[model samples]
Target: MNEILILSEDVANMVAAGEVVERPFNVVKELMENSADAGATRISVVVENGGVGMVRVTDNGRGILPDDLPAALQRFATSKIKNADDVYNVKTFGFRGEALAAISSVSDFSIRSCRKDYDGAEIRIKHGGTPSGVPAPAIEGTTVEVRSLFANVPARLKFFKSFSAEEREIAKFVRFFSVINPNIAIELSINGKNTYTATAGMDMTARAVQVTREKDLVYGESEYEGMKLSFVTSLATVQRYRKDMIIVGVNGRVVKDPSIVQAVVTAYHRMIPDGKFPACAVSLHVDPDKVDVNVHPAKTTVKLLDARDIFSFVHHNIKNRLDDAGHDQGVQMRTPDSTEHITSNSYSRPEPDTKYDHQFATQSYDIASEMEVVEYEHRSSAEIVHIPEQSGAESAVRVVGQLFNTVIVCEKDGEALFIDQHVAHERVLYEKFIREAAMTVPSVVMYEPLLINVGEDELAVAEDSKDVFDKFGYEIESFGGESLKVSRVPTDVLNRDIEAQVKGILADMLEERKDTSVDYRALVMSCKAAVKAGDKLEMHEMRRLVSDLFTTDNPYTCPHGRPIVFKQPEEFFLRKFGR
Candidate 1:
């Protein structure tokens, strides 16, 4: 018997469905693309139970003809293209014709359509079964309903996510589409509750505001080589933890083009802090012949003919706009306040005093003339308390003063010890937290919970590290949307910026996910909660910090492997003075 015979048609379609319809979001994407290609002005999408139970898409567009209803479900059948040559110049979104076939192969699918020349018709198919069409009432457009998705493939159904998570993915796709097609009204509902909707006829900026939920935006426009670019980017002040807020689309299709996104981010590198991402909605219109949309199975990844040129164009234009805005602000600053009439370049170099120069020239050169006499009130050597010769805890150390408000200068054993106050405090806190984690650390309940808006990547990291966070006395819960509410924080971080500390911890944890042995959570908490350099400390606080540092098991270095203390021997100073 032949072991590798061709699979049955039903089985073949089920296998192909895996690529196109990976999740509920893909279903929504393919259906919406079809609607857009049909010249849809208004589209509605309704899903129940995270699109596992049902997904219905209704579009008021030029629907399919009654004669073409059956072939719409046939494999490799599509009206978007006629031959192989047309594939190179494809413009429509549903050229592969596999979306509907693959979708119907895995789910119970039905399509109802009405064209101008024929009466409305309905087609029904069950899991790659033969299609059946019936005469129905004349509905102006098409409505595709899919029920019990992945019912035939139980293994795929098991991998479905929570309803809310799935709905969020669908919402993200809808928002991207809405931003790209501002003239098309789109509504999305989950379990009969309207979750997102965008009205038609909004201009680019207005539509971007509605889609990104950002109001402080700067608009940019540039055209080159038949490609037109329009983008609405968040001000440099507006930053997020992840790049998920940056949405890029090419020719009315939302794509995951990394080069374009990198261009925008590189432009803002000098303006924003590191590890921060600015929200942007960039729309690029290029001729369909110059780009290839058939690269990916989902058609969300495209290859541009002039990708490098596009990137350089976007980068320079955004950078120039930001520079112009900064220049205008500088001009405003020098516009002369009510009392001053000084321009930016108003200061001029003054002439030297002639009398002092002439006197210096006439006088004899003497070293004593450069020095000033001083009277000192010296203390007796007997009154000084000398440190012990032993290098143990028995020797006492006295804090002299702080240097540059960053390091603590202490006198010990006839030597000076320069301690990095920040690292000393960090080491102390790290050990303290390690001990507390073994036991139970007290959690301080906040009167008002801190709401942290995180991108999808950060949220995933947080969700994965929930138990670790709970162990460290951080009580975090998803508070709807892309936010997490923190009702309780570690007592060590009570007065600190709880949101920034938590997000920092999450970001570090994500970076260190592969290394399980590292205590990133504790390290992050300690670093964030510790007193930083340049912070003024009272005498008592300095004494207490020094005392705490000595008590730690490892007082010489911080948790991040930075030296906390540096000692200079008296012999070294004597050698410096040529003793």
Candidate 2:
């Protein structure tokens, strides 16, 4: 007998299932892709127990004929391509033809499809067995149902996450597809509870808003060298803590291209403050011949013929839009007594002023010196603070006086309380803005819209962030090549230099840093708008600040994690004076 023998078909299919059907999400993805390729206008996905118990997808598209039903479950059988040459130019989502075969080998699978020219047919395959096909009720589309996934493969079942976690993964993928395929009405149900539904006929922007839950997005379009790019991006002022909100699709297929994502982030460089990412939906259309979708088994990664050129193109276009929205780079603003203003070239000692005492000036000098003298070095992650919930005790605190015009002195229950003026004010303003943001804040329309001249790069950033400006009450529009017109301003900053404030907001949007929960735009605005160190406040203002600070949710720290209030016991005085 020969030493080597061909593997059994069932064993081979089971092996393929390891790659093609790694999880329930994969099954859903493949089925939905097939539906899309079939010209599905309406797709519905229903799952139970995170798809471990069941997964069903229905599509109203061109279905399979009874004659083709058996072949649809056979390995290497597909109508997507004829020969190896056609593989490079493949446009449909499913070309490998292994999805159904591999999926059926590990679970109970059935597909019911109806073609306009042929009688309806149904195919059933269980655990890699021979497929059984029969005539079924006449229908106009296809419905694929998978049950007891990984039932025959106990080892694979162990790798699955909890029901809720797995369901979240499925929901995430569905939302992504819904945004990219706006023309398709997508509905998802988990455990019979309708989770998500996007009605058909909505444009890409509208779909993005529905999926992302963000209303401050600006739409942009650009065509470059036979490629088209359509994107809806959040303003530098509107941001999320994580990069998960950024969605990118190539040729209508959602992908995980880090380079493309980085290009988009780079476009906002120096326009958004560091440690924040803008929420965006990017759709790229390229010639099928210029891209290869066979790079990964999952088909979620692709190879481009001119990746660098594409990256540059995306970067330029996105940057131009951001600039046209008045988010041009190179604008900086100063915060009173903030260490951010200290630089080696401009570092100098300040003369004492009557606004603050020597102690406050000394503290500011120390902070500035620490910032200026320290050499550049990477810092570790920030320390997490555990804040207890608020209670009635906070309301009893009373303001005493100001210390060095920086710290507010207060008295409560025989304890001396000291609050950092800047941090305290930041907390108050943060809460106030958050509350105002929940409502419809008023706006101030400019009598004459201000015209701003910008470079190509600036124009892109401005245009991309126009909607963001509008959301914040600044109505800005493109005024022809490299110029923007600002017709409205945020009521809060009407008295300030509108142009300078616009530039500052844009610059902050482009700056890069670590991820943070602090809204960089709001933080920057609050910091600028708040009363700073060395500003003398009347007794009533001090009392009002202390009163308002106590009313906030977290009175101890600002939005940026800086401590606001410090406490000292009366016993400390006894120890100091030896009473």
Candidate 3:
């Protein structure tokens, strides 16, 4: 055969399709992005069979003219980027024109759009880069329909997940966009059932209530130069859903810059329990050049020109707001009339379970139950005893230090260990409280039942633990359809934020249950009431920490599977000092 190599345009387009269409969700993402780019006020997405059977996105944005329908389907052709120079100052979400060309190559794709002056027109195209028919007149807005997403690529079909899983992914993506763009109405439906719908032009609190199902009462807001930062941190009673609610942005665009997330976390580092994440959202406005959005394909990640400055800005913004507002994070009370938006099917609570590790054989020892220990007016001064020590070849290497308030350092004979302080405390508390929670416990009053409205999703979790609550000295009852009332509280949580503590308990239940199968609710409550890091500790406190750490089942690590301690080898220290 003569050496001849000329690839067809269809082959090149198919190659490009791989990047634009990775999974069924990508189709919905692209179409939705296009709708937002077109200035659509309302967008709706309908999917069937995880979007493998059918995917359609409708937007009420400025539609394409009849003359532009054919050209819009062409590869590398775009109305988004007029010239190469315009790429740097680009602001729209869908600048890359590869979405349509790529979609058309993999499936039966069609677009129906109408410009302001002209009637809407529909253009249909089949696989292999050929138009099945010409554009025909249609409706007022734009709607794109895609069928058999990977029909032309059978190899890709093998990777599709279960319909429910795919639907979850789609739901998550849609929810994020809906939150990011609160002014634009978004509706999502799966298998002919409505999954999510958000109001157009809603305020930040309204949008937050829609997404998180918690209180949207603005705790505080502040202005810095040209930017304004506002937030409504969860009260102690609200069930926490994340370890850190570190949403960041420059001029309303959500970016995954580590500095931003880190700064926000740092702002509330002292306030939050080790593993619990606070709930808040912050929006910033800045010059585009100062923030680069071209970092990731999904646009979630970004590179800021002045990351340190941005970090400082966010920190100051949060601090100023909190200080000025005099917001009492320690208060366990909830604002009345706060609405919760969650469905029964949004998330469910798990049944009681227990998990035990068999890797290490147990050694019998005398220990008081947590409740018994707490009940004693004065802790007994028991003699300090050291356990059997490891010797010779079998001894494990260890290293240790403190990083952020929640991190502990440990290095074993040679390996490095970084421990999460919060998780470690969680593990320790888990071991202590699980036992206390099983017995009939007495009510220890810290405060009167602080009525707090919880999100429906979180309420499901709280309701699941009614029996556990009764056992742990907590007299909790449903206050109303949307709230929880506490007549009695955990004795250990005296002088603490009762509402935040309860929310932390719910969060702990959800997180640790998947791994340990233990009474995570009790564990969460223990951690919430425990002493946090960053509080200046005396020698006694540090000694107690070390001693308590060693007493645990796995002294080397914390509860969340992160190391609890790290040590630097003497030789390394000597080398550094030039001994």
Candidate 4:
């Protein structure tokens, strides 16, 4: 009658299986990691029925040994680490041997491998953690096959999603890994068809082109403190995710550190439109140890030894590229009106602040006063501001002319502003959209409220914001079980499909929480509705955009750190024309 009884080996393994083999995707992750650790130049993954029925991973690596094949599939066994101390300096991708053992315990699993120096070997194991026979001769490299995942654990089987959903998740992981290790060739196939392939040892631009199918209009490259930083960014297309394809790496490993991503976002802030994510590939080559890769179990995250220094370094690198591309106001050369052409009356402003009651908002007075006194003069509401005296502040130059419904040209004092009219206007419109979004309160709709279904994890977030939504005039009733019914949505967004807008709002709010500190649902809604790059704008509208931009609270950048305006300075024109 002991309170705790010793469980059988089968029971112990089943428990472990629950942790490591949650789904077929988990099996694919483990096998892919093993193949990566084995130094595979090319790794190919094939999955069937979302990996519920079959998952196969083949690698052209050194492969496993005949003598070690049995031990490799045993519980708590690992070749990557010998003792506990080795955990600190561990570099291999697959350090936990629990992957194979746990996978074998819950599904039919087989491994075939051959080291370059030895003969091939093969082994098969079934659910309940037992090997059938000794290792036998096989082909070179490694091929792992897992079948009927979670068959022994029907409870886990219940968690299996639709095959297409699971397949997408697996495909996402494969693409992530492929992007991280561009030097390693990777091929991912769904069922029998190849879904994706990456060229081995391609440069960052090449890799991005191959993976994203988007052209790499790399602006430029530069070095900071002896470490080279390259900017592989697109001119027009932006990503459709919370984190736009801004992948940062040091010494060839992928990292998701906020500081690094923040720096890049900050650098581009105000250059792009609000709520739109730019596609960028920023690769930094520095000493490997500067980054500690042992921070996370999956190594998708990392710790930078000098996070601040790295942040500043990368921020400046991107900032300089933007400036050189005539993305900053100060150094650009063009007509102020032509660069940011608005209608004659579109750039209206408040009367000059002669009363000196600037105390209402003091912190940003210098910038505001400059705009009020200098920018508003000479330019109609449709015209852009041109400031020759303030060459240091690139933002002083505003758009003067919008040509061919595509390019914006701004000139002030001795500087000119030439910008991709679409991108610049997108930034302006996006900012306005964000402002409109923030001001709009949700309206209560009494007619059969729409129900928003969410998982348990998302329930808390929805609940916490319920009151906030109420303030915006939205009434949400809890469905008692695990869902929320929306009785109302914001009125301004009424033009959009109610269901689609609400769903988009919720998803965007959740993503904003992850991407930036501003998590208000209203703000997220605004960001998602903002105009995107490649959106066309008329000349007068572009001019109005420039005028409105100068009046914004954070016109220098967007909410997410992308620059909305680029300036051309007089010095550049003087240098080119020799005074």
Leading candidate by TM-score? 1
State the C-alpha lDDT per candidate. 0.77, 0.75, 0.64, 0.63
Native-referenced Cα lDDT, model 2? 0.75
TM per candidate: 0.71, 0.59, 0.60, 0.54
RMSD of 4: 19.2
Which scores higher on TM-score, 3 or 4? Answer: 3
Report RMSD (Å) for each prediction in the order shown. Answer: 13.1, 16.4, 11.6, 19.2
Q: Write the per-residue lDDT of candidate 2 for residues 144-239, one digit (tens) a residue.
A: 999999999999999997787688778888988888778899999999988888898677777777666655566788887789998877656554
List where candidate 4 sits over 4 angstroms from the true fold. Answer: 1-23, 134-138, 219-231, 236-241, 248-255, 282-300, 324-326, 329-579
After superposition, candidate 3 runs with Cα above 4 Å error: 1-7, 134-137, 157-161, 216-245, 249-254, 328-579
Candidate with the greatest lDDT versus the true structure? 1
Cα lDDT tens digits, model 4, 461-576, are 57766755654555666786446787665544445555445545665666666655554564554454444444566454555555555565555566656665566677876888
Of 2 and 4, the candidate ranking higher by TM-score: 2
Q: Write the per-residue lDDT of candidate 1 for residues 183-294, one digit (tens) a residue.
A: 7999998898887788886666677766665555667788987889887777565666667778888988889999999999998876777888877888898888888888
Candidate 3 lDDT: 0.64
Ranking by TM-score: 1, 3, 2, 4
Model 2, 190: alpha-carbon shift in Å? Answer: 0.7
Residue 403, model 2, lDDT: 87
